[model samples]
Target chain A: MPSPARSALAHIAFSDLVVLLRGIFERHGTSAEVAAVLATNCASAQRDGAHSHGVFRMPGYVSTLASGWVDGRAVPVVEDVASGYVRVDARNGFAQPALAAARGLLLEKARSAGIAVLAIHNSHHFAALWPDVEPFAEEGLIALSVVNSMTCVVPHGARRPLFGTNPIAFAAPCAASAPIVFDMATSAMAHGDVQIAARAGETLPPGMGVDSQGLATQDPNAILNGGALLPFGGHKGSALSMMVELLAAALTGGNFSFEFDWDQHPGAKTPWTGQLIIVIDPRKSGGESFARRAQTLVAHMHEVGLSRMPGERRYREREHSALHGVAIAEQELAQLRAMTGD
Target chain B: MPSPARSALAHIAFSDLVVLLRGIFERHGTSAEVAAVLATNCASAQRDGAHSHGVFRMPGYVSTLASGWVDGRAVPVVEDVASGYVRVDARNGFAQPALAAARGLLLEKARSAGIAVLAIHNSHHFAALWPDVEPFAEEGLIALSVVNSMTCVVPHGARRPLFGTNPIAFAAPCAASAPIVFDMATSAMAHGDVQIAARAGETLPPGMGVDSQGLATQDPNAILNGGALLPFGGHKGSALSMMVELLAAALTGGNFSFEFDWDQHPGAKTPWTGQLIIVIDPRKSGGESFARRAQTLVAHMHEVGLSRMPGERRYREREHSALHGVAIAEQELAQLRAMTGD
Candidate 1:
């Protein structure tokens, strides 16, 4: 067998990758605007070594678009709801475009009110959630976001799957370093990671999921096929998952994780649900600068013998990508190029 | 060994318990208003069977006050910072009174602006977090809160303790039932629970903590004596704990868990940190009543074989308490009575 690390590799400039992905998205039925937003998001993920949400998701996005399960060209309708709230109807399109359409107004409200919330519904979210919040932190604001996906996780103490692998993402600015950011799935293992492991014919760690018989198993294939994932951290993680359902779906007037049915669209691969983003302007906080205080906390974390911060690896990957280009498998790059009619 | 379950139990009316606790607080140091707020909070915890934060915490409160580590008579100063922000300087007092002082304004802002945040600093929080949020849910709003405690938990991948047993609590209204509520310590175990286990001469589940030598151990006494707890769910829980420190302490301009040193006042059991509460008015949402949507989700959860929901146990205990009075160990009740000079 070929050594995986020594396999043929392709490296592309981040912008070139974004342009290539944009071509693929536009060719796959998305509007140029939607393509631009999604391509950048996907490219950024790839550049930061977030493979599951990078080019790995392109086929899923394409298939869903081809199946007509999502309206790639639908325009988002932004609502200026209140002093501190903005709502968006994604019109059956992807969530990124909805956020892009409402981002300016959301920022304005957050600045003026000290805090603001954006509610996007009737949308499909199939990307990493960190992207939704990180930019706010870059702008010296704190941001938190939650998105509920299709049900594949069992609520704690439940006999079967009833909740999505709901995820939460948070970002905060720091003084002399990258913004602190983390995006975590409430499930013991993210569905995409499980898929990756199954594709690689790898076994999983114990307690990640159960087989169809509801017995514990370490086989990734079992978890992916007729089995279910468990919530991370037991009941606490389950409760956070439930909270995600409430905030993203119930509060945003979108379909619950289990409410959407796509069996009729056989190629559909996206969950039609909702997303919530909250932005807070730290200038309104008391005493010292929030970023400086965050830096101090990070310093203490290092002092306590921590070798890495939660999102530090991503930052390192980002820097490496800046110097050496975004890495990809040569075979996958060829497939992507072919999809764009190269 | 004696059967703990068969221990003699004492029952006291919830209101009576509040009055008793209030007298104790007032007699110790607090003003009537502060006493009223804390007494009710403490009594409610006992009524809901949250023993870790109920009567068991009163001695710590008294000792902290008597040692002059906290100003029980200090008046919290509430500031209307912005359309969606409220700030409270707790004046080195308890967080509950600060929250009480700003809550009315916070609610008005949340209703008017759609969402609002309250930042309380220079405060000590030594109570169950759920009580801080549950009332907001009962008032038809969504609430989430975080508070940082004294350092005792080791961040994931860190060799020593640096983070507190920081906790996050959330509450949301549900139709046809009590609100959904949860209060979770990001730590593998709450410090109070470890203390309780140590007092009972019991061992803890594995992965809960490390001894002073930084080796994993199940002995609760070791965890309480110069040892440290671990974050729940490993890295994910550690990230949440870090986020708690940023939100509750950094953003509020309060001391980080490791920043405060209470050695001068030897009996100081409280962490003089900060707290943050975010409230949202669901009326601003696009949904068919948010509460009704939540109810639909809960129904589906039950259909999927979930036998109980988060916070259901607390509600059940509360119902029992209402019917038969709040249950407490007979010995503990005697101690409480003596403390009140009754």
Candidate 2:
């Protein structure tokens, strides 16, 4: 039904996409190496069909850098406190390089001690979290990471917004196939969706948000005006948000969703978030049979349906896109090219 | 208009309940020390108003012993293999004593290493998980635990049951007040609720379960007849279940939900389940200001709502029951008294 060469259905070369992103970041004062890492990650997301976090978000990052809200040239500093604990101060910069630098040391510690924790503070993480966790899983390790964001979502039941759409990402290594990874926001709906619904004058699904009086409402306009987003699955999702606040913000001595100051974070910048990541070597915990056993479990899920595993669809998208290149909408491509001043 | 003492409002002294439970466990071959730990945990659950996991589940444990499903007299053996890793071979026994023995050592490891992982296998975990995590939080440590159970919940989009309701518990300690704890199952509805609904001829919520043909249905009768329960929040909850299975069961060399052998378990017995508990010293991660910071977060939540915190109501119940006593239904009390052959 659609031609690959058509403007509406064009597939951009993954390398070209990464290069364009890298050039933009480099122009904004990020080191070439760091820009490459960040750009590669963004490109990979687009390749894997996570367009929301991929090329679509570049304009946000550009505006953040233009407003001088984040220090684009800043490099992270690492601190190894204890045997299994490591801390990285992103120094009010991007989270990509800091997370990258911490990963190798974390893997070494987990291999020897069976588990290791990495706490990244003063970081602005705009990218999807799975890229950060999937690397560990690919290296035969289990990884979990959660990060706090600017206050955009509400807790289970409260009057005001005090929590973030704090997302959690987890990955497990498989012996016979690709690693299984899933990343999800704790909010019932992302703010962008609520905004679009409001602009379209469409009623939202119940439980997506609340009104100014903290009463549940299906009106997106009310949610946009003064209300807040609800947590997914009611109370369970709220508890998870609390856990994320503690683990990512409090534990790292970073900004909680409610505590982030507008003075320190100007414009529409990524908040100075904190991420806590745990990497574990399954060989020590699960014994030598861990990988084989994981494969069996993965196969069982696949036996039933097209999508049972958490990130199966993502992986499938990745496989096809790797060979065919990433799909880019014509309008989106024009916007991306406009950013490059082409 | 509630009476202090009525047939439906019978109260039992917490001490008396613990003593009775201790006697029953001892009669079934558990050592006094292990019985004391188990009984204290069970009694606390009742006092905290978690009736489902409290005295209500004692018959399940008793039946486990009668069926030789667990070795009541078994003492857990802890093997400290790595710096930050500890494995407890529960030796096919109750999880209470095994967890009790592992707690102190875990604290020491976490204090020194900043984080520690405890993988427990061949254990029957039937009680509330918060008791285990709360102790760590009380000691100024952060704790997270997840456990897998017999297959009862289906993965998202699957017709057959493939995962457990698999509960996850997390706790954070505060400086000025009680610790905050939250534990939840990943199912939209517990299997027990479905069975009760079916027997009572009540319909269920739309997304709670599926019928024999795997179509979403509200009919409880259809669910009971070769149907399965759904995960909470659809795929997100299912991902949590998958995470639990990997962290708790697969990582511990125990059974995945589908792999749980019913042939080895009979009657109202608890099956051999695995639990994975992680303990981290916030002092190492967050520095000395951790507790105060945590208290501020907790206070902020309480400042808005009556009970936004997950275990706030439970804590209130505990304090009331401690001052007075646990209120138990007369019919339920008679059943417990009968179990004790009083």
Candidate 3:
């Protein structure tokens, strides 16, 4: 049993955590600046209540790097940019740099034209897409970002894993509230969540997963072994996942389902993944005064007693954490300290 | 009870539908030009198997017009355009002409700027987003079109209707197969289908809708009166509905839920009604020749046994209908003839 106040847990300050993460990444061959950026992103995720995407995943990422799956030192290089379109090659680089380069280029294109699409190939996993979309939303733009990972979910009616837990994120700007951002995975549950459930010895949620025999089941172990996560809805979610695969993987020149299998080979040294980021400047796309009207609409929805805007709650959480540092479960804190050899 | 025919029902000449629809619209105060466009759009929807969006919707539309809810004689006019971004004042015109004009202008902008977005305000309902999307798909471009209609569905937990059955359509050019087009409503079932079931005295499918008491129910009558259609998969689907509304309505100067009582005013007369259409040129975006790589990615998915591409089945249906004219249910034919006084 876990205790709320366990002595094994140490409360390392947020800054300390960032420094430790940067140190670890630097030791693993990441450049100093890149390590700092990666550390900041990890910390930000934790602040935003996205603990699943935060530093808790750092150990697995390092293991991937150690296994020679991800190149810690690679950098993103521009492939093309004209009019309102941009193409980027990550050169087997960390996803952060690639995403950064793509966003920068996309902003440039959007500033020049009314809309811009940044297609990126050969990138590694980019953490929670909300961060990538937020900056664009802050600039009064509407943005959609998607990425397709290695296969982990099954199509509707199929037993085998044939698609990634492809996630799509969209952000819209508002004046008073935080930007409305909706980020989601097409699968009923992400593979990482399933692994967590298995480790916890808990039954998976109904309709979330299936067993080796192609029947829906609640056993996480069975799903992790040979079964697959079902899509959110039957065919609609499957169609959405395929759409993401084509847009992110196909359009960006990355491998699709059959070309790369996460099950056959688990860790890194896998083929480079793909991502798509689209930005629409509301000011440019819908006349100069569109953002103001958008703000009014946001206010209207809230006035009607909608609980919260998509990202507003997250933003509120982040604000609270920034004022009073975030709290982690005692067990997770202890694990982090052990991993750091502190 | 309806019977499934071995072969499709007898062909109803498309020209007959076109002429009848045109005559009906003309009698309802639409100009000859706008009526022609509307008829063409309706015919195409039927051809593509989207019978819900085709001539079946004509009766309700006519009633709205007869009640002075829709402005059938108005013409869409340009409100603003800067840096490839455009805003159109539909003047409550028929949706087909207004939306088509926006698409044409956006394509022209894309030709010069590589990407473009067109925001249309005060437009009436547009049927079958596929037809609107396919034109861009045919031009070797990627397109996304979305519309926020009268509030029809509920958000995740809410019993009252708070969101429209917003539909998002994405179209991308493919190599070997037809263009990959996905058009989906955020609700578990489109509201039109509920109406269809109600008219036929059939029970709605489980999870399709909710009764006025906020209980999930299959009774279409309750759903029509005050019940809400649940989002497809609860939170995720609700998030998508919000996404479409923000992008389509907020940015395009449309009314938010609280601003308009759609039940009181079914026709699109409010100045707040709006839509957003985006067109992207793949040739200008992806690296090392996007078209060739798009073909490769699509083939790889097919090779992995996807069974069918996203738009392949729908395109096949359209092809079959073109070879043998579209089928009309006996009751539908009678209703159409009576409405048109033909």
Candidate 4:
């Protein structure tokens, strides 16, 4: 990608960015609270340098709201299906509020039951999964989450897309320092990352995906046009994707990747997906020393020239972005401004 | 790697194999019931053709017992840490009996609470993880298990072994067929498989592991000599290994991979590690329709030329072995008979 046109670049404080995003969603018809939740999440992504899931996603999201593909005024409902289980119905709306509502409940339930699961359905989760699990880890809980999205990846040995990127996130709190966290898509490359590469007119590295004929290719345009992404680590990654499909979609009564022909749609629609979250109270394991033990393991990673833990790079990026402000292209800012008449 | 000396072969009924294993363990010191639990698990692994974890592991196990590295008479104790949580202290014995004791309780707890976790410590887990989770899925529960072993895998980019193979297993129930399951090691190749390749005078494929100085190598001898196994899928698998270390060792109060160097030890001892089991009831998500939905997903996999689900191959192997009888090399039979004086 060429250098950003600096004359059209704008660096806004994190606080200001949040306000801008919140106002844009509000103008598009979401409740103030709902918009705030979505805005805060997106801004955090920007702060963490996850640009694909940050403000860059605004255009498609606003389009979904304006078209009523996602209900702007929806109030997610939660049902306590069992002592330690929660089922969240997002009511065909954005996933943020629904996930937020279950967050506290999950912590509470995990503490009492030792473990808990929250299943969310009929939601559009156009964000990173780390944000959802990271909070639990910060609160002294071990957390894991998986979400299925529009089909973009092919199962191992398959010629066509039959599974979503299906990212899985996990986090464990540490002593004093930030939590150790990882968020990864089951695909060799994430669908969002692929889209970014395609937009930048970049050719993908070899082996990330294949063309429609099932032949491996390095052309991003060919992939975005009619090709399918391959699973990471070949068969091992394929198995992980299969597990995510079962846990999030089949179990939650949400749309499976095969059920959605995302490419066939005339207009972009909300990603109707399911999410599965698991919360575990570390204290229940009789470990007040879990954090320290985890640090011992992490120290070994650092020694190996790995440089950073899974989410450590993101934390550093977030701090730098917070201090310097997040940069957005002037064109992107203008589009948001136009969408909201700001 | 050479063909087994079939002239020294024995065909044993699965039931007789279990009884013979039980008798040997009982003679060593464990009570009849404890031996039965362990023996049954070992036989089942053989029945499923998981030879590495089956009778092939018996020699080392017997050595551990003979050396008193593991307490053959130890009775595992379980405490209900919370409504849905259980902690099992294996008292320096094998993992099978400890897991068996908690199996029924896990199902009941999950039925009522929708999720349950069982943590076993001070145990030696040598059998495949599928047996632990497969029973839960058979009982109409979704199950996942992770166990950390003696460290043999280097975290991605690291030269030293600081993480175990750290296998994770998952199972989901279907309507009428056997449960769908997968058990995978985070390592690019299992240590046992590497040993087999070395014995066969075969070169390992690239990216499987590194030599002692951290240079990538295709020589299995270099890998098994002083080298460390690489995590599967590079960094993604490294992240998965880290998670297992946290969940099974850190959270369960067991030793981390770096904390133990069993490979360097001169004496054979049980892998004094921990196992974490999680069971979830899909019925809590509101319907008995889960099985049909899972079949729908499996159908998609089948159409893609991925003919079998993760566990289907093993299931078929188990069925064939059950009918044909398990084959044991005559020398292997002699070895077992010598150890047991039978």
Highest lDDT scorer: 1
lDDT of each: 0.93, 0.81, 0.73, 0.82
Tens digits of per-residue lDDT for model 1, A260-303: 99999989999999999999999999699999999999999999
lDDT of 2 by residue, B1-342 (tens): 011113476788999989988887887667898789889999898788776577767777788787777888888999886889989989988777888888778888899989999999888888878898998998889999999887767788776878877889998888877898988889887654565466456778788887778888898778778777788987889889889988988898777877756575676457577899999888886454778888888777766563556787788888999888887778767777777765
- TM-score for the first chain of model 3? 0.89
Residue pair clashes in candidate 3: A69-A268, A69-A269, B254-B272, B255-B272
DockQ of 3: 0.48
Q: Tens digit of lDDT per residue, candidate 2, span A56-79?
A: 677778888877878888788888
- Please give, for residues A201-281, the per-residue lDDT of candidate 4 as tens digits: 778888899988888999887888888899999888999999999999888878886675445434455578889999999
The DockQ figures for the candidates are: 0.90, 0.62, 0.48, 0.71
The better candidate by DockQ, 1 or 4, is 1
- Model 3 over residues A1-342: C-alpha lDDT tens digits? 111232343344678778878877777667786788788788777767676677666777666667776777887887555677778887777767777766766787787677777887788765777787887888878889888877768776454677888888988877766677878889998766776677667787699988887788999899888887888977789888877887787777766644654444355533357888888877654443656666775655555456766676678868877777765667776656565554
lDDT of model 2, residue A103: 74
Clash pairs for candidate 1: none
* Docking quality level of the chain pair in candidate 2: medium
* lDDT for each residue of candidate 4 in B50-139, tens digit (9 for 90 to 100): 765677767767767776667777788988888889999888887878888877787789999999999988888877788888988887
The TM-score that candidate 1 achieves is 0.98
Per-model TM-score on C-alpha atoms: 0.98, 0.93, 0.91, 0.96
Expressed as tens digits, the lDDT of each residue in B1-342 for candidate 3 is 122122335467778778878888887778888888888888777767776677767887777777666677877886446556777887866566777666666777876676778887777775767777877877888788888876767777554677788877888887655777888888898767777677777887799887878788989898998787888988888888888777777777766544554466665332236677887776665455555666775565555456766667667768887788877776676667787765
Residue-level error in angstroms, candidate 3, position B341: 3.6
Identify the runs in model 1 with alpha carbons over 4 angstroms from their true place. A1-6, B1-6
lDDT of 1 by residue, B165-271 (tens): 99999999999999999999999988888887887888899999999999999999898889999999999999999999999999998899999989899789999
Error of 2 at B38 (Å): 1.8
- Judged by whole-model lDDT over C-alpha atoms, candidate 2 comes out at 0.81
